[model samples]
Target: MSEQITKVNSWVLGLTGGIGCGKTAVSNMFEELGITIVDADIIAREVVLPNSKGLKAITAHFGEDILLPDGALNRAELRAKIFTNNNDKEWLNALLHPLIRIKILNDLNNATSPYVVLVAPLLFENNLDKYCDHTLLIDVPTSVQIARTVKRDNTSSEQVKSIIASQMSRADKQQKADDILNNDRSLNLVHIELVDLHKKYLQYALHNKTNSH
Candidate 1:
C-alpha cells in the first residue's frame, strides 16, 4: 500500500461500488467539491467506438452482428452474450482491458486537479486498484442493493439477484476498501459521508501510483 502511495501523482483517486451502490452520487459530490472525474464506463464506450482498435477486435471475433445498423457496436447484444458465456467475456476483457488501462493511465497522468476521481465498477475486479493510491468503496447492504435495483430498474427480485451475483460480493469489497462509506439510510447521510470522505481523501494526500502485480 505504501509502495502504491509513492507511485501516484497528486491527481488520482479510485472510487468504486457495485450495482445500485450510489457510486455516481458520491462521485457527483466530489465533482461539486471541485475534483475532476475520469469514468471507466465512459472510457469503455470510447474504446468501442466505430473503427477503433477495440471495435475492430470485437468485430473480428463476434463478426458484424455485434454492430448496429448505424455501425456502432451493439452493446446490449455483446453484454448479453458476454454474461452468458464466461469465455467470451474473458476474451473480450483480454481484448479491451489493456487498452482501457493505457487510456486511464494517460488520463490520470495528465489530470490537473489536486486529485481526480475514477469511478469504476470493476476497480477491484480488473486489478485497477494498483493504479489508485487509495480505494474507497461505497458500502451498502445487500438488502439495499436488491431493493434499489428492483425499484429503480423496474426489474424483478430474481433479476436483481442475478445482477448482484455477477459482481464481487459485498463482503469481499468491504474487506478490500481503505474507506467504506455506508449508504443504507437517508440520502442526506450518504451525501454527508461523501463530503466527509472528500475532505479526508483530499487531506489524506498520499500520492503513490505503484503498479503492484
Candidate 2:
C-alpha cells in the first residue's frame, strides 16, 4: 500500500498467501529465525480498536450495525457485508487501507532485525508488494486451501469458497512473487525450506547494507 518508506534501513520481504494457506504458521517459522515480522492482520485489528479513528470512520460509513455491544467492530457481520457487495468492500478499503499503510510503514522503519517480514494476506491485492524488496508467496493448491480453511475457521464450504474467490488467484500471485515456498507438505519440510530462505535473506540484507554506503 505504501510506495515509499519514510525511513527503511533494512530489506523487507513481503510474505503473503491466500486464506487457509498456512500464512500464520509460515510467519511463525520466519519469527523463529529471529526475523522481525510486521503482521497486517494484527495491525488491521489495532486500527479498528474501540475508540480509534479507523473505527469511527467505519461506523460513519457502514453505520452502527457494523459494531457490537462492546463497541468493537463486528468483524463477521462486516466481512459478510463486504463480500456480498462490491461497493461496501471498496468503501471499507478506502477507509482502512491508508491507516493500515501508515502503521505498517512505521513498523517497518522501526524494525531492528537484519531484515523485516511484512506478513499480509492481501499483500498483492493491496499493492503492499511495492514496499518490499522481495515478495514471497506461500503456495498451496486451491483444494488444499479450501480444506484447511474450512477446518480452521469452521465456516461453511460455500463461505470459504466465496472468500477464496474474492482473493487474487494462486496462479497470479505465483507469477507476481519474487520467490515462493510450496506449503502443501509437512511443517518439518516447510521449516527446512524456510531455514534456507532465512540464510538467503540474511545475505540479501548484508548485501544491501554494504551497497547503501
- Give the clashing residue pairs of candidate 1, or none: 5-208, 6-208, 7-208, 7-209, 8-208, 8-209
**Tens-digit per-residue lDDT, 26-75, candidate 2:** 99998888889999999999999999999998899889999999999999
Model 1 lDDT per residue over 114-145, tens place? 77888899899988888887899988888888
Q: Where does the lowest 10-residue lDDT sum fall in candidate 1? A: 1-10
Candidate models: Cα lDDT each: 0.82, 0.91
Clashes of each: 6, 1
TM-score for each prediction? Answer: 0.86, 0.90
lDDT of 2 at 87: 96
For model 2, the stretches where C-alpha displacement exceeds 4 angstroms are: 1-7, 62-65, 80-88
Clashing pairs for model 2 are 1-128
RMSD of each: 4.8, 2.3
Tally clashing residue pairs in candidate 2. 1
